[model samples]
Target chain A: MALTRDGPRSLGEAATGGTLRLAGYLLLGVMLMMFDHRNGWLPRLRGAAAMLVQPAWRLAATPGRLVEDARRQLASAAYLRRENARLRDNLLLANVRIARMQALVRQNRQLKRLLDAVQSLQMQGQLARVMDIDLDPFRRRMVINRGARQGVHVGQPVVDAHGVMGQVTEVLPDTAVVLLVTDPSSALPVVDARSGVRTLAYGAGRGDLLDLPDLPVTADVRVGDELLSSGLGGRFPAGFPVGRITALKPDASGSYLRAVARPLAHLDRSDHVLLLRDLAEPFGPPAPAPAAGPPAALLGPAAAGSAAHPAPALRHGAGA
Target chain B: MMRLDGQRVLFYLSLALAVLLLLLPLPAALRPLRPWWPALVLVYWVLEAPGRVGLATAFLTGLAADLLAGTLLGDQALRLTVVVFLALRFRARLRFFPMTQQALALLLLLANDALLRWLIRVVSGVPLPPPLAWAAPLAGAALWPFVFLLLDALRARLRLREP
Candidate 1:
């Protein structure tokens, strides 16, 4: 090493070597960025690296977990008792609602039979815990503690109680990355629940809002109307609540309307989330069978909402 | 040889700790205040142990960080490479600066990194990061003196144990 470095030509050689290496690294970095941006040619490599570094994420999350545990432990026993009683009462009320829902579902099936409409797929949701780490601030994404090992795959919808969240983008062995509805790259197909007018809602790069761009100026929409997933793209299941229109105004071009909305799901505060799997694609197209032949175990496409399993009644609409 | 082995161990441990600090979740209000942990540690190594950490080392550390953070794979790599290159290129003049001046220089370097980050975000079609993100360089600069002192104490103790 000394002989090579201490040579008379060392000064010139080192400068050239450093410059060449920097250029080569820069070139490689640009190529990598392109590949990653285009979502091409790097998933396998990233997945392998993610698997290897999974322990690091665990290590980083430990302190937050400990703090949460300590907070729970320090809570007064009286408070815990009150919380338990409240939960029990809520459960009883929910049970009554479920009983009513079951009857309604049975009646709906009879109507489907009368109309000879296709049987809808039943939704069974699995609860996944969200990881406590924040990702790139510019990107609305989060890590959930469920992955390929738990039957999670890319494009599965995630939702909390209040409304649509997002779909899985990358799945590792034990964790998956969920791109939230507010990511600029994300777009959700939504229908105005009152007017039945369908449009696409794009992420506005903010946590609380989504944008509906390029709407015809005379479209029927109001500031307070609720938006539900249209399920047109087969990615999100139809009828899941998305957000409520907050503002509607003319775009700069004046030929189209720009509508803004406030998402119904609690974007900032959520923990356990439900992952919805559309049995249609996984179970080879919904079986066209008699309505009486045991309720269909799956349904249309998947709609994802942000954070928490607060909407078990919606996602777990099976067992009816 | 034994001393060199100990130094390597210390270097790796310091890098790992910096990574852990970077990964720690900050509260929403405090997130913008997160210091550039890994880069600051990398600067220390490049300034003090030029033989050990070079461009390739910085790039690889960044790649690992990208994978762990689930960010664009080369984003951090490019940022770290530029930082290490500048630090190495200016090491002779930088090594002798007093604490205040050193931190001022560091502010410039970190600001360069922040610029690269903004460029990457725009070019990659991501929305502009919040304005608060620019404060991160200030946070890193504010913590520089303490980081330098702590790492210096650790390095000094390691050297003292050399027999």
Candidate 2:
């Protein structure tokens, strides 16, 4: 640069320094990419940076929300009445199911006590509104309006009313990023509800399908079978309805079976989600929380706040 | 060494608007057509106010973009640096080209940048982009004329020119 300042120089000569700087920036970019791929290395820094742009995320959601709001207000009275009746009937049906579930839970707890087994789970749910939908088309992810300030943290299980949706992969001051179960890199462990055969459900990458790989060809899974979370992944609570097996196919090697299931969760349109505050299963490493059976009143604020979920602390070690 | 002038304010404001445009939410059907706003703005600056807009400004803008877009850190930084460098290297000829010719050059440049983005996504082991993803460069190119005229109005109003 100093030499070029006094003498006539070719463009290449003048740009040598610039070329070197460009190379340096490119190399740095690759390094950052690698680090980010490795579970978003340096999440704290990313979280802090994410705070500055939280408002932008909010602003982006406003137009869509406004449109929905306007449509809701302009809805016909007959449509509203019909929707209200349908919802009321659905709520009544759900309440009955909940009552039956409570009775069954009591019976199960009594049986566990008689067998000297671990205590039952009691998880709570927090609702958050989705702020952005699939910010990037290539990846299955969405941003939510809840964040660290709302006790929304990484590794929380996010579900909609229908079933499992995804897990929180990142959190900012007022927004969070949830990695959908349909993302190519995501995997969920599920069991055939009838046959009790456990298999891993991997994201099929097109955004709405999950493929069960590595099941032996003779595996008992069949079309129309119900799949439920097996609680083996530590991130998801057990017994949640995952998806239904849609088809079964034999792999190229002919030794194992591959199954595809359409996820039950409304992955494309679910705007309201609940974050389950459940801890890890009992089989996980010993947790910092006290032994089970303590009253909610006796537990500390963090534990008590999350006590509604069966055992959330056990998995914090694994997922966090 | 930017002076506190209307041109300088307009430069930063235009860049901010570009950033907002990039983050603006669009319906799924319209997403593929979202122009690469930052690159278009940078191209305009490098061509019109070469002394003020360069590698450093591009780098910081890229970082903010990466952070906001939730993409890998430095990815946008690297892209901006490359765009600025290419623009600077060819500024002499690009300045004299016809409007249509300039827009075509931007199309090719942005298309290559899109390819770079695909490579980064592949390296990160994410899902491959849909075929419709290629439309971004085309959309960006088509939008160049309007962007050029708009930013030009601001620069010309302030008498912004090459140093």
Candidate 3:
């Protein structure tokens, strides 16, 4: 640069510096790429980088969010009343179910005590808002508003009102990244609700479908059979609806059946989700809470406050 | 002689706007046609002021883009660096070209950048993207004249200097 300050330098003279710089930059990029691919050597760096860009993302998303908010505010009173009434009915139904569930839990505890079997713990869910959706066509991911600051940890299971949505893969200070169940890289162990046929369901990358590959031809999975998390991996709680088998095809060899199912969760549309925490021992009572008249009492004031904040299009997970 | 004061603010502001456009969500049907905003903005800087915005700026911007877009960490860094390097090498002619010729050159540069990105993705084990993915560079090239005009106007309005 100093040498060229006096006059315009020839292309050859400039190319020397430019080529050296390009090589250095590419070398750095390749090294970072390798480290990122192998064992995630720089999560902290990524987190810091994400933090730096968070403001831009937030700013970019503001117009959309504001429009959504304005639409919500413009909802007519009759519409609001109808939604409220429906919610009340759902809450009433949920309370009745919770009461029955508590009784069954007590009876099950007694039975376990008599049989000398270990106890099972209850799972708690935290509410979080979906901050942004990944626009990269190759990956299905969402950023949630909760993160390490809110006690969210990596590998925690996330769900919406209808069913399992995804798992929290990366947690930063203020947000966590969720790889949706519809992403190609995601897989979960699930079982048929009717016949209890266990199989692995893999995301088909189509936003709404999962593929159950390698099921033997004799596998009893049928269309309309609900697939539930089997608790085999212990990462996700058992019995949550994963998807409903929608189609089945036999492999070319006719030895294995390939099944496709639609995820029960509204993966692309839901704006809020529940993050399950402290799954406790595989078989132990959930953490004790004041069993007030409603199940909402279980979430304590802080949890209830966050959960009931009326976020746009958010639905509380059904009765835990 | 071009004044040199206050240009840094305009330079950074244009880049920020590009980042915003990159993150702005488009409807699903239109997503494939979304222009590569950062590439266009960086191309402008490479042509208009090569000394100030060089390989390092491109690399850092690419890193930020990789983080924002949730892509492999350095994939975009390498792509952007490659384009910026090429642009700088030909900056003399590119800066002097008529609008039509400049847009054509930018189209090739953006195409090279897209191909490099596809190569990196394939090398990194991603399946080949659909043929539709190649449309981004063309879309970006189509928008280049507008982006160039808008940022140029912005620079003039802000009384930004040329290096």
Residue A33 of candidate 1: its Cα lDDT? 88
lDDT of 1 by residue, A124-237 (tens): 798998787767656778788998999999999999988888999988899888988988889998899999998999999854589999789989999999999887777888
Tens-place lDDT per residue, model 3, B78-157, is 88888888988998888889998998998899888778878887777753455666887888888999999987887676
Could you tell me the TM-score of chain B in model 2? 0.92
Q: Write the per-residue lDDT of candidate 3 for residues A1-320, one digit (tens) a residue.
A: 22233235456765889999899999999998887888674466767776675666677778768878998999999999999999999999999999999999999899989999763657788999987444465667787888889999999999998999999888887888898887878999898999999989888865347989989998887889999988876788888899999999998888899999999998877888999986634523555643334344455676656553433213233433
DockQ of 1: 0.47
Sort order, DockQ high to low: 1, 3, 2
Where model 1 places Cα greater than 4 Å from the true spot, the runs are: A1-17, A279-320, B1-4
Clash counts for the predictions, in order: 14, 13, 8
Pull out the clashing pairs in model 3.
A119-A283, A119-A284, A120-A283, A120-A284, A120-A285, A121-A283, A121-A284, A122-A286
lDDT string, candidate 2, A85-193, tens digits = 9999999999999999999999999999999978457789999998753365566788888999899989999999888998999888888889888888789888899
**Top-down lDDT ranking:** 1, 2, 3
Cα lDDT of all candidates, in order? 0.81, 0.79, 0.79
Off by over 4 Å in 2: A1-17, A34-39, A283-320, B1-4, B29-34, B153-163
Predicted model with the maximum lDDT? 1
